[model samples]
Target: MSFASYHDNIELGDTVILYLSPTELEAITIKRGGVERNKFGDFPHANMIGKPFGSKIYAMNKRSWIMALYPTPELWTRALPHRTQIIYSTDISLVAMYLNLKPGSVVIESGTGSASLSHAIIRTVAPTGHLHTFEYHEQRAQLARQDFEAHGLSHLVTVRCRDACKEGFGLERVADAVFLDLPSPWDAVESATRALKGPGAKLCSFSPCLEQVQKTCTRLRALGYQDIITYVGLIRHLSFSHTKMQNFVIRPNPKGTNSNKRTAEQSEATDGDAQSVQPSAKRENIEAEDEETQASETAVVGNPGVKWAPIEFATEFMTGRPAPSVRHARPHGIFDLCDTPMLSYCFRGDGLIVQNDQ
Candidate 1:
């Protein structure tokens, strides 16, 4: 199966993606007598041959079935065997976009582990461009080359076995963009600079540690590379469900209470002498107004018989539930850096101060 091109029906020796569920997908090569055994049942390869690329094939038991999907870069990422720690699609997209990859673009990639990002890059630059990928390990390089040949993408990518940090990419002024994934990327900054076409060419480095990024950026800046920045890609999950909350009702205060109070104040003022009654009447009127203001301000809904209000949040149309999470590294520490001589941290009312003696 050519990942760069699409076909209608499955052919022998073609890689097929068996989509068992949203979270479960497996890749298999179609052979004449090969059978895929899973919890569902045995899915014979003979039954899958000649079927449509996306046709659903039932197991031998005929109770459960799986979708026969054509292989794509995204699906391949999920289904590819993990030869090493490979880059995921989230980071792949960021790298591709930042490197400004396009058709006819020549790219240099180091340490092509598992060929996950390599497939995606090949698809983006197929039919016109080429990818020069280098791997330090010979076995990995050979396996990646075989996979590329099987996918009919050998013309679009070239796999080489070389440690880029010590040997460098060998080619100069040939790459439009370069990607580095190594233990010490700073050691290859000079070599990457020599490989770029000229000014405006881009370079991207993937490092898990902040110190690595720091050293890489320093080397890049010293080599005259501009606009050096580091970013972390994070995915947030929003929970959607129905929540029950209390409902309030507002009712008018009874008029009888206010009227009875006013009447008594008026009677008391009338019993006093006229001179004293004038001031008393004014004071009584002010007091009545104040009481009314206080009552209006304090009015609240205290009814316990209110029906529950069902508050529904935004619903996920794709999964019909919470968003699916991608594999990622969890943070090891909770801390923030401030521009000061000492470090200060406030976590849930606990304050910590560490002096930066360096």
Candidate 2:
């Protein structure tokens, strides 16, 4: 009795995260009574039954073993076959947050890329919610479609092969959010508005260049997409330098910190606690690198240690004749436009134009 496709336990046809080597891991679907052959050794799928989602699987000889885990969205991002350049999880997570993605969220994403972000987005809105994703390349779209089916995610995703910039998103005001990861995202700003839902529907564009951001922001303002903002989400990962410990075994953390559990025991002279306590280092040497980056974004616009050059535009783009005051953060600076209640952004004093009724 095997489950069709689920995330909790290993299923016969579900793709699992296979630890290929010390430095590499990939996604491979499990098959009943099937064998996986590699340099490490042969792994039998029949032996993986009833194991938890993240349990480790050993080789037949028990010498070379690998972790046979369920594919999480984060794991999927790292292990997916890169049909195109993909956005890492760090940026993807924050973007998901900025877009206010929850269960049952209907969103639009342009240029599926490796479908890295799409997988994450689909997971967030699974079971009921759906994602309408547009990809420029038909082959990439088809490949992504196949991947979704393999992961049992096709029910929550729609991969369309269309140029969102030229032909538009082809979706009405049904999107709770619109995320753009394109070369020229400015061309689709107008199209995104058509697909976005009612007031306060968040939108985000992922671009590597400041020029692209500026152009896209400009177009978004022109098209009445309010709360125009940007973001650069950076995530640091800690890497510990390892030494060769052949017999090293990682045990479950008992209860409390090592340092806190000691010394006071000598003062109190408690034998029961110290006897049961295990000998473990209080701290380990660590190093962190910012592996995630999202082009700086937010709705909380503020004067953060930068010279703001205000504009005196009169009736250029906005409807008001108060001469919309536009300000630019000087010298390649990034602006963070946060939420401002009672701040009329009708281009009077603020540079942003009012879009929705809110």
Candidate 3:
């Protein structure tokens, strides 16, 4: 299968992702007679020539190896330069699908930060479509242009170094969709309306704050845009691991009284009778008990040394039954390790959509 835009055998100047490891990847272009040197080893460019993508090449020392794979949009986004905050795939995928992008869609984008998403857009709107992207920052615009040319996508994209907020975009009723990722997106609402080809042309703006979304929505509706709706898009990754169950014998509370405590003779008698019950009867009893509990903050075992301490547990603790727990580093910790990102981030994707009146 095709990785990104690459479909033929690897040759000169084809960008590839050097998969050193799962987390360790380096984006590079395959150049003849060129060599890629890393701490692991030196990878020769000529060696990759004529080799189909997805080829694995081990270093001469055999101690290190890397996989040469196609640069899909997902991989490109992850490997792009973090010059500024770029849209994550959670929002990108939604917008692309929501806009109904295909092989002939025309798109307008403002504030092309890092042009990370632009690549995906071009990929979706290529072979006949066009993307007119406006970037306020001259340096950023120039860099984006370079990126398009480098990826051989310049024919499909037009990067303009003009401010869509103050000066307004230079297009008029020629865009199938408009995407704004600006700090003050409200200021460009009028411009977006003017850029749309007709009623039903999709308009989307990405903002980082609720205040921005509210302001943008107001501007969009006031500018005669119909059917405005807003939403925050989010993406979550779930993982599963083997959990080792640690049996914790229940312990008596310090303030236990006769009403709450069960006598050993009584408990033994009750247990004997419970064991005699049918399996279905036991399952029903256990399920009934699970329905009554909520959260947990402490785990006290029968051992005297183990005092009543808050036991960090997942939301599954509501079952009241202690199951084998697979410890997690916490969502906050995961966010932190991924560059101290916000856990509940709502990329201004779903926030507002102006109904295209046909």
Cα lDDT tens digits, model 2, 43-69, are: 898878678876788889899888886
On residues 1-358, what C-alpha lDDT tens digit does candidate 1 reach at each position? 6899998999999999999998899999999899999989999999999999999999999999999999999999999999999988899999999999999999999989999999999999887999999999999999999999999999999999999999999999999999999999999999999999999999999999999999999998998877888989876766655434346222222231222233454556554443454566666665665576455423322224534211110011112453232121111223353332111221222222222223
Model 2 Cα shift for residue 224 (angstroms): 2.7
lDDT, residue 278, model 3: 57
Pairs with steric clashes in candidate 3: 200-356, 229-352, 230-351, 230-352, 231-350, 231-351
Name the candidate that leads on lDDT. 1
* Candidate 3: 10-residue stretch with minimal lDDT: 335-344
Q: List candidate 1 stretches off by more than 4 Å.
A: 237-358
TM-score of each: 0.69, 0.63, 0.67
Q: Candidate 2: global Cα-lDDT?
A: 0.69
- By TM-score, the best candidate is 1
| Model 1, position 251: C-alpha lDDT score | 23
TM-score of 1: 0.69
lDDT measured at residue 178 in model 2 versus the true structure, 0 to 100: 92
